[model samples]
Target: MSIHPYIEQAIELLKAMISIPSFSRQEGDVAAMFEDFLKSTGINYYQRKGNNIWIRSKNFSDQLPVVLLNSHIDTVRPSSNWSKDPFSPYEEDGKIFGLGSNDAGASVVALLTVFRLLEEMQQPFNLIYSATAEEEISGDEGVASILEEIGPIDLGIVGEPTQMQMAVAEKGLMVIDGIVKGVSGHAARKEGVNAIYKALPIIEWFKNYRFPLVSDLLGPVKMTVTGIEAGTQHNVIPDECRFMVDVRVNEHYQNKELFHLISQNVNCELKARSFRLNSSFIPTDHPLVKRGETLGLRKFGSPTTSDQARMPFTTIKIGPGDSARSHTADEFICVQEIIEGVNTYYNLLKDLYIYPV
Candidate 1:
């Protein structure tokens, strides 16, 4: 059992990254540091777009299929409830604590370490390692901006805090803004349609209606009415009602199709924010999934979205740390977790063979 020799350096790199505040859409400083680290490792030909940084294997061959190893480099702005400075990295027991340490810094540095090792050797498929920005806010400047340069990818491994388990299916996010129209009138007159009253049934429909297609791995499509604005005052029957829906779609349907179904059922005028991040699922028979099964990793569908949402390819999400610890006041990832992440990632890719996608 050969262990990753540079695990120590990987941990140090994560610590260094945590010390810098790489908040979403504001990762210029940390991106520069990441590039510096790559240069130090003799990897100087990395492609940079926006704040995302990506590099391919030195012996990258166009003939082979490409496997993209991706993780985000951005953290959310620290909430007002922290016991320690969020930007400061510290260690306690076997855990490293700081912002972004668990959510993705651990995975980013682990993948970079594995990339260094893989570049020194050779794999069945070409490798592209990327540390992307703006995952926290799901901004356009992140992984989405780099795909054109990295070219086609057959498969992607999104590194997130999944406790080393495999997320074969991930829920996609779609926000819908809705408006219900009615005629305004004085409350005493009782002669006008109340928009707020009109919206109740539509909101109830979102809560009760179920999509026909249900994914076995991801289960049902979930939608919630997260926000609403209706009445102008107590005396007047408001003519317009606006609401926001947070939809968690399964891979069984596209966002646009789901929107059409909902709009047909509800009386409100509906508009989907964007259909780009529709739900994603990799087949259980996919070689990547089958490969992880050999290592006895448990498979489950993730309700949360990650950088995987941006990759329109066959992808799996797996990494160290616990998803529960991400964005907490005292965020931490075990040092041992990073060590195992490197080993597991290396084992998964060391001999991976790509078939037609």
Candidate 2:
């Protein structure tokens, strides 16, 4: 009932996590830190081979299904222009400033704090606190392993920074790579087929490509050419040109259909050269979303992807901190928002476990 002690604990945990720089696959140290914290709390937990940690409550019961609270432990590479050291935790104007503070460490810290509180209160439902890795480049290894080992679950809350709003749905992502081939020759000779020139048509097509607008709980789908590279020298005609495209799809389009459209419509050599594609994930609304909405949480759609894509479960994305602040220099999250996030998660657990009627 006393929130002050819990808030203080949350702040301490956030400081501890920020003190360590766990970038993507390099999360062993922070994972160890979390494991030690869970052990100190006397909770049952273990570390997988990939260094991902999972902690469970001992007071688990069958009345309420098992709930998995998930967040990534890794952060993107630190920016070079931080006012303070990226790894050093600092407080300014009621906000915590650090590299991963707004990106996801805030949520991880809050979740761990909530887990400890739940352990102390002896919560009824089987609770799992999962700090996963490799979320930035798709969570193929970390979340996949957890799903394969732990099997299916009743519900999952993806602790992504949504500024404390409830995200019931997110757009599915498709990553496309286009390779164009051409003849390599001296630039002085006009006889060479320039690959960069070949790629220009496709790039132009993309510029004018009209993406279909599909209305769903989350609004319209979008396509963005995120990366492009071609030519090794200024005077030589490039033999190969490669570019990457990110397509955000809605429920109206299937991955297969979208890939087909890209392959067929884009003016390029489809056989010898190539196009590679990767699909996104969609999580349907579950009982947990409904219950959280009743608790005064605002619902919205997410344009980005998360670790939820790598698993098959009734997943919802919720947490504190602004998405705009994420991955930016001087990234930060308000101390007050972190406290509110803890209370929101704590209440969510109580609703699902204690009052499931």
Candidate 3:
């Protein structure tokens, strides 16, 4: 009638992490908690500016390939619909509820446990464990800042809420601001060219525009006109119209290529608000992916973007919990999911080997 040590430790660590409200740019307290845990475990780690902590096994040799295990320690602000306090950890029917319990707390502890287990074995590749910060907001002080210190990472397993499925491809993100200009005059007399009218064609183009290239896994690039503004008063015609476009890009096209496609087709001035989030993909024939296949993890294209998009190296997204449960009113992770996560992670890496072709 006793729980397994891995489950007990993972649950305890997840509870401790969820007890602290580490929202977006504020992960100081949670980092301190992790520092204490690491100290008690007698593990060496490096702390980046925003509380991003990472540790590499002392047993590693530069001659071997390295695999990175990473997950964020931040959460989005809780919504108003929660039944209990967001930061307070609560358990019911084998589930743990809190702000970040599902989004990544489950993955963090699971990976930490896996990292500890792997340290005892002589593996074919080096292993690096990371609990990064500021992932919710795409902040500069998070994973990107710590990679240089960790050195080169040939492959990575970026953890997120995926129900232990393998996210082989993740979509990229881009936002654009569009401007349409015209002369201003009285609206009643129709004495001037209306910027809003000029913008209509551009907006319609965005609604119907489709990039010819389609990814076998991710399908197509999706574009949406999210916002628009024009006209100050009903009595006068507006000289300028402004709008915003949100694009989810597939791996087949880069952000810049999508930008060019938009700019070339639309007859309006355009400015890119963001273009850095690049799509990520791993071929089915990849050794890690093949290993995952043997372990029975389903492959899917993730429409949602994760820290994987920011990684310069190839990465696969797999973890506990449900993506639907993330950023919700009563966010939670099932006890079963956490245990499954530990097993899945272990199975995926247990027989991994990286060699030059």
TM-score per prediction, in order, is: 0.97, 0.82, 0.97
The lDDT values for all models are: 0.89, 0.75, 0.89
lDDT by residue (tens digit), candidate 1, 216-326: 888899999999998888999999999999999998988888888888898769998898887888999988788889998889999999988888889999999999999
Model 3, CA-based lDDT: 0.89
| Per-residue alpha-carbon lDDT of candidate 3 for residues 277-349, written as tens digits (9 for 90 to 100) | 8899988889988888888889999999888877888899999999999999989999989988998998888
The digit string of per-residue lDDT tens for model 2 on 189-272 reads 886789988888898776667757564565665767777788888889898888877777665665567778778888664321
Candidate 1: residue pairs that collide: none
Better of 2 and 3 by TM-score: 3
Question: Model 3 residue 340 lDDT?
Answer: 87
Q: After superposition, how far is residue 14 of candidate 2 from its true place, in Å?
A: 1.2
- Supply candidate 3's per-residue lDDT for 317: 94
Better of 1 and 2 by lDDT: 1
